[model samples]
Target: MSMIEVHHLPPGTRAGRARAWEELYATQVERATVTLGESETGPTLSSGTLGPIRLVRIEMDSGLLQRTAEEIGHVAEPAYSFLLQIAGQASFSHYGQDCVLGPGDMSLCNNAVPYSYTAHGPVELLLIRAGIGTIREHLPSPEQFCGRHLRAAEGLAEHAVGLSQSVFFQLAADLPEAVHNRVARNLLDALATAFAIGFDDLISSSAVLTGRHARVRLFIEENLRNPDLSPGFIATRLKVSSRYLRMIFAAGNETASAYVLRRRLEECARQMADPACAHLTITDIAFGWGFNSAPHFARSFRERFGEAPRVYRREKLAALATGGGALSAGATESV
Candidate 1:
């Protein structure tokens, strides 16, 4: 939650600055070959962790950085970096695509693959790194967006960059952890929207359907606690026909109602297994996720999870307490 201020490595000589810059990139950013065009003025970096995302602000002299295929194998963890060009221009090459981004432009860079960027001049950039798994859930075919310049002065990209700038410059370090997490989530949502809009024409129709299904799933998850949540409501809210909505969900081989019921039951089982919900009764937990009838909820939960609600909860919780359960983390549904 605390902002990490990485002071410019004591400015003295070009050699010292170059070494400092290398060290900073190796530690703060991903390890890559950094060629400094003007070694006298080393790059300045300020970084921090925002929940599951990491943010870094860098101002550096012109340079070229490369992450080669050989280097990628050594990467301990793979992530996607959303780079916003705030000043100067840069050219990026990745996935056989090349792009040039000027001020108020952005691009998504995949760290899992080889890529390179060369700055035309002194540059200031905001780089956000998040787990690929976390971002892939929201944006299908993330690879298609990589190395493509997105205009930050228009549409969702503008809003996303603006919000990120506000957090970088205006937000105080003392803000609560929850507030920082919320900001990070909002930023991701904006970026997802930007990518979705920017690549609309480039993606195939099936991809568009997948994207729509993802959005519908997100809507359902957000409104899961509402008893009145239904496919019709979702279609109206998303500005699509109920019939079209069913078609989208059908791509995943499930009806909208079935998906909703499955998700509700899964949510109930999740809460029942969570220690934080220990004080809540089985019926309370079931109703909390919009299950109207206790018996029906119990039957559905058992059918999905292979045990009675109370029994499953007790066994799962006990296993967790003893560190013996194969309780897998839930993955976001993908179409």
Candidate 2:
């Protein structure tokens, strides 16, 4: 709960405007900077270490920009970390996996894994330096925080962005040491907790009983991908009652069975629409989509989509390829 904010002065004293960067005191300054013609110049070598986290936020100038980014790969390979590009883009190599990150884009990886990257566009890096060693010393496994990249979801970008600014504001602006340290600790904890909740929310949002029922839904969807997936199994896995799972889904215009069936149908439609899947029999398609029985699949498909699975796929694909007829009928028809 401590907060800090800093905006540096623009070096634009040309028109005789006041100096943009003002020393607030011994350890704080605020300014706004706007770069003109880029012959490339800046104190890009600057970096700082948070009490338990390595922290830095900087706009790159020519010297750092021109340097081959590959030479700096070692700086990235930590247990839990994310890099956000505010006004430019970067390309990164992580454990032999290459990903290009754009403005407002973020990249995350297990620090224990090998990583390297480069940016081609005007680069601004807003980096988050948090890891298992610093934050997750008590977790079941540090690796749980690693292995996948989490982006600032377009919907959650506003909240996601509050993080970088919070850190930058604190470091570059004034606050008591006691307050600063407390805020820093909270920032790290808040971010890690938010990330953990977000990851859970992500997995659960794809479930039938998502949102208020995130944990429940996550259990259901994760198990859904298994053929043996069922309400009983899902409830047990979630450590919740089957009646509770049923109640959660029932509030969302569905019973658990209906919701599962609908999701399975969507999956089946996707697989069926793939031209590569033509060789598979309808029964095979049904089972693959998680319908344990063919007749039940056919009946459910017809009830849900107003047509048999084969006819629906044929018309949908034809509409997609040739663009007319029953597919048009299906399009405007009721969901």
Candidate 3:
């Protein structure tokens, strides 16, 4: 959570300054070519890394950043850039959609796809990067939210932007690992809400089914600590057929059971990483999160995070103690 600052270029020739700017953009963001405007000042970037998420704040004169098809091929895995406009304006284009982003507005872009951003005069933005796995854990179909304007200054979108900005600029650098994980979770939840609102037309067209799906998810979240929270139990409690419950989850390419297991595991991981929960044994945390069988939780946790739960907790705690971040094990499909 420690911020690293990249200030203006050192006194040098114009060509040298341009090269320096290009290298900084490539490293801080994605592999892209930067076209600087007619100005002597270079952009200022402040960046921080929290686990799998990377946050960056950029302030610069008008310029263009282009990611070509070849650059897309070079990416090792799918990821996303959630951009929040802090000052001035910027335009973004990706996957055949284009939109202008003004202050207090936000948008998401796929890093594995060809995209470009052009700044109008001076602009400032906070960009949050997460692997596709992390994005999918929060947003079912993340791609649908890409390149669309998510306005702040009112409603849920405003809260999401404010949280993002606060995390980027105000997080105490020494927060516990659990706090960092929770902050990331809450931010993503807010973004998911805003993204859903961005799809008003789709929700309106399928209002009944969408309403049912929302109810199902809310029920699951509220009862996650209940070991009996199964698909059959959920269907019965919500007055929906098991077949219909499956159908609702199918729309998101996930099974109701899978979602439950994923969430439970996430909760267990959060507790395990928390120092306040250090009094609780790993098995206690698992059981509290509705994981009944120790062996089953072990296997599933390994598969999901690419490590045993105890090992993950140990490494996470150790990293936090030393003021460093640890990467999550696996990634999921693109948005």
Instruction: Give per-residue CA lDDT, model 3, range 1-335, as digits (tens).
Output: 44455556665776787788778877777777676766788678777776678888888888777775557667777788788888898888754457898888888888765567889999998888889889878876666566667777545777788888877765545546667777777777787777777677756656667667755765676677789999999999988899999988887788999999987886677657654456677788888878889889999999999998878887776655435543233311110
- Note the Cα lDDT for every prediction shown: 0.75, 0.51, 0.75
Residue 198 in candidate 2, Cα distance off native in Å: 4.4
Question: Lowest summed lDDT over 10 consecutive residues: which window, candidate 1?
Answer: 326-335
Q: Between 1 and 2, whose lDDT is larger?
A: 1
Per-residue alpha-carbon lDDT of candidate 2 for residues 63-109, written as tens digits (9 for 90 to 100): 11211122234334334655566766666644223466666655554
For all candidates, what are the clash counts?
0, 11, 2
Residue 270 error for model 2, in Å?
Answer: 34
Candidate 3's C-alpha runs over 4 A off are: 1-7, 172-178, 203-335
Least well predicted 10-residue stretch by lDDT in candidate 3:
326-335
TM-score of every candidate relative to the true structure: 0.59, 0.41, 0.58
TM-score quality measure for candidate 2? 0.41
Against the true structure, candidate 3 has what lDDT? 0.75
How many Å off is the CA of 251 in candidate 3?
A: 17
Rank by TM-score, descending?
Answer: 1, 3, 2
